[model samples]
Target: MTVAPRIAIDAMGGDDGLPVMIEGAARALGEDPALRFLLVGDEAALAAALSARPALAAATEIRAAADVIAGSDKPSQAIRRARTSSMGLAIDAVKGGAADAAVSGGNTGALMAMAKLALRTMSGIDRPALAALLPTLGDNDLVMLDLGANTECDANNLVEFAVMGAAYARAVMGLAAPRVRLLNIGVEELKGTDEVRDAAALLRGATDLPLRFDGFIEADRLGRGEADVIVSDGFTGNIALKSVEGTARFITDLLRRAFTSSLRSKAGFVLSRPAFHMLKTHLDPNNHNGAVFLGLNGVVVKSHGGADAGGVANAIGVAAKLVRADIARRIADDLAHFRAGPRTAVAAK
Candidate 1:
């Protein structure tokens, strides 16, 4: 009999405390009945929270964590406290074979440091990437990587990200052959840094991989919904991700202000309420709450720190999908094939 995936959660990681964490776990359990949780935090607090929801409490196994990692804690400092902290314990559960995956809504830097130090990168992976799906105008969401993990990356790293991102796309997005692209200054062949250009060249030559390389793509076209997987160094990727998020918020805020500006505007808003609701849903960060650290030896999903129960549940959903799909194995297999070297088949000709 196949066993259900058990997830280890950092019960004290996020901006919100115990109640939100427990409620989120309950919500996720409600969605996926087969999922079991290993909640790591203050045992007494967890027990009290779980008492009201006996169903979640029964499905959960609470582990004691004496400390919580602060949002301002540096990665180096967080690493030192890994043994007793809630985030640390949750990751430890995954490492020790108690859980299939770990989820935390904590300091991104600290989480990366702890997860890397604990789980280590998969074989042939130099650095693990933080990948998240972004809203797009097309039928499917776009997968962008290295959101804030490795500030600088080489050609080989970008190539590796493409392979891992493609596997991730298949696992989460259900895309059999995801179209991959590098974030660049221009779509032209001569654009971007040496690393970006070289990675593009390498990807163009590797048609054997289970992905379709679509060459370079300008950052401006990221949300047009054409590309499936986008690769970039963490420095550039983080900036782009923030810019996109800021733009979304600006638009949303502007819309709200305009709608409430006057009686006429309010009437107009009511007339187009359904369309506005769709737009609001599309721009909701909670809808895209999970960011996975790809290329890790095991699965570790990072939830937005300010996420609500619904957002936390969505993040858990991302982790569950990865565990069920055996995404780590798929990435390992792809890396093995890719490391064997690409054929001399450059589509750029």
Candidate 2:
């Protein structure tokens, strides 16, 4: 029998740390018997949580780590001071080969900082981008990257993002020749700032790439399934991503209120219950629980700060899938090819 990959989870990292993460770990272990978990955090609290589950007693192990990185602490200082913070300890497990991958639901900036310092980046990847899967109108989801990892990116950096995003789409999403686009203010060739223009030129010239480059896509068209992978600077990408999430929540809440307005409406809601549930699954942030810091030497999945047990479970699942797929190695191979060419710059006209 094949042994399941061991995943190290930061049990004291997120807002709902001990309860939610512990619950999620137990649930994941139950679903996959071969799965092994290295729970890193306050040993006493973790032991208390796991004590109820006798079945998981054998599959799960706890690592004692005293410090907890606060969300407000500076990333560098936190990393230095909290040698045993849940996030730091989880990364250490990966480094020590005690875990195949690490998942954490904590401060985004701190996570990135710890990951880069701990794992480093692959060759040719100047910086790693936080790539997230966003729901689209079609059956397949869209991949967006640099989601607040590096706010100020150059043209070459954007091109690198395109390459990494493409690999993620193909490997993770199982897309063949995934359609790629640059996120911009307008769809015109000459739109936004000089950086966009230069990046467009670079991508246009690189038709020999394995993936399909579909040119610029406006932020408004993101959800319309125009492209499988969208690339942009971290600042803009973060804003666009958060806006979509906020809007989805707002619309869902409005619909819920409308459906429960009166007896007639309530009857209609019951009739359409299945469809509503489907919609909820598609739009729910909990369902799309993990974001990968792509281009890193090791797999590091960042979960939502507010993630519950379901979300944490989903994150562990994502980490396992990514490790099994050998995503980091695939990315390294793709980057080697891209960088082997005559390094071309997106020149300003």
Candidate 3:
């Protein structure tokens, strides 16, 4: 019989605190009956929260953690108290084989640092990257990576990101062979920096991989679903992500103002209410809530700190999907196939 995936949760990590985290878990459990949880937090508080949700309580086991890492804490400082903190313990659960994956809505830097130290990178992976799914104009979502994990990336790192990101796309997006591209200023071969150009050359020459390398894709074409996976350095990826978010909000606010400007506009909005509702739902960040740390020995998903129950549930869902899909193993196999040689190996930092 197949075993159900167990997820460890850092209940006390996010801005909304335990209530939202527990509720999100409950929602996820309700959606996936085979899933189980290890909720890490103060025993008394967790017991109180669990008492209210009998169904979630039934599928969950409370694991006591003595401390909570503050959002403002630095990664260096947070790593020292790794054992006692809720986030640390949750990640430990994964390393210890107690859980299939770990989920947290905590300080990103601290979580990344703790996870890397505890789990380490898989063989053939130099660094673990942060990857997240973004809404696209097409029916499927785009898989973009290095969402702030490593600020800068070398050509080798970008090539690895492409491989890992494509694996992620297959697992989560259910594409057999995802189209891969580098985020470039222009689509032309000569437009990007040396690292990007080098990475492109390497990917183009890479054979026997499951993904299709489509070369460079411009930022504006991202939403058009030109590629299934987009790879870049963390600095560029983070800025581009924030820019898209800001633009989404701007368009949403502009529509709201336009609809409320006068009675005629209000009537038109009412007439087109269904279309607007679809647009709103499509643009909502909660639907695409998880930022996965790829290349780690085990799966780690980072939810937005301010995410509500729905957002948290979505993040948990992403973790569950990856676990079921066996993303890490697939990535390892692909990496071994695509970049096999003495020179491909890099010493871990």
Most accurate candidate by TM-score: 1
Error of 2 at 229 (Å): 1.0
Per-residue error (Å), model 2, residue 338:
1.2
Worst 10-residue lDDT window, candidate 2? 340-349
TM-score for all models, in order of appearance = 0.96, 0.92, 0.95
Model 2 bad stretches (over 4 Å): 1-3, 260-263, 342-349
TM-score, structure 1 vs. true:
0.96
- Shift in Å, residue 304, candidate 3: 0.9
The per-model lDDT (C-alpha) reads 0.91, 0.84, 0.92
Q: Which parts of model 3 are misplaced by more than 4 Å? A: 341-349
Per-residue lDDT tens digits for candidate 1, residues 1-349, read: 1158899999998999677778888999999999999999999998888888999988999999999999999999999999999999999999999999999999999999999999999988888999999999999988999898998999889988999999999999999899999999999999989999989889988867889999998899999987999999999999999999898888888989988999999999999999988987887888989999999989999999999999899999999999998988999988777766555343233
Q: Considering lDDT, where higher is better, how would the candidates rank from best to worst?
A: 3, 1, 2
Model 3: per-residue Cα lDDT at residue 249 = 94
| lDDT of each residue in 1-94, candidate 2, tens digit only | 1148889888888897778888888777777777888989899888887788777668889999898888898887877844668889898788
Q: Pick by lDDT: which candidate is best?
A: 3
